[model samples]
Target: MAGLITCLSVPFLSYLGLRSLPAQETAPRTIVNLEVIVVDTESKALEALERLKKGEKFSTVAAQMSIDPNAGNGGYVGEAEVASLRPELRAAVESLQP
Candidate 1:
């Protein structure tokens, strides 16, 4: 009975160790960059921004005005982490107060 108990405890301890181990979570299906086509031509960036200001869905405006040739498929330019744009566009995007 003692030997059997120890054997049972070994598996239980193994289970506990595994359960406590950090779980590796894959990122939620990454929004593919291809999905956010930013048509950002000098002519078009503002048009899309205007639509966003008017409360249009950003994705919709992206679809319509993203200047990237693939805009029809995935109009994304990944992201523009605040400090990265040209001072003017950065000012414009940051000023949106979104």
Candidate 2:
């Protein structure tokens, strides 16, 4: 019947239209297992980074300088999927190499 064809065609056309839409880009994601030493000021954070570049032990610097609660735990935040993080943080984490 005409009514049946029309109903079926509507859904088929709708499906085609939806399928033609461009796919959205998904953000990059990765598992991360790393330590961080959080400092209160940018200057202090830079200093910490410098220390790391010079091969200072991460746990020692974290214990001495980090303001994060996890400092006592040697700044271990454990594993996390970068995509599950907030947008800015996810982007930052994705830019880094292992």
Per-candidate TM equals 0.36, 0.61
Query: Model 2: per-residue lDDT, tens digit, 38-78?
Result: 88899999999998899998998898899998899789889
**Which portions of model 2 show Cα errors greater than 4 Å?**
1-29
- The local distance difference test score of model 2 is 0.78
Q: Which lDDT value does model 2 have at 43?
A: 99
Which residue pairs in model 2 clash with each other? none
Clashes of each: 8, 0
lDDT of each: 0.55, 0.78
**What would the per-residue lDDT of candidate 1 be over residues 1-98, giving only the tens digit for each residue?**
35542211212246447434333443333122223446547567676777788998766776677666656554555644555556886566656632
Strongest candidate by lDDT: 2
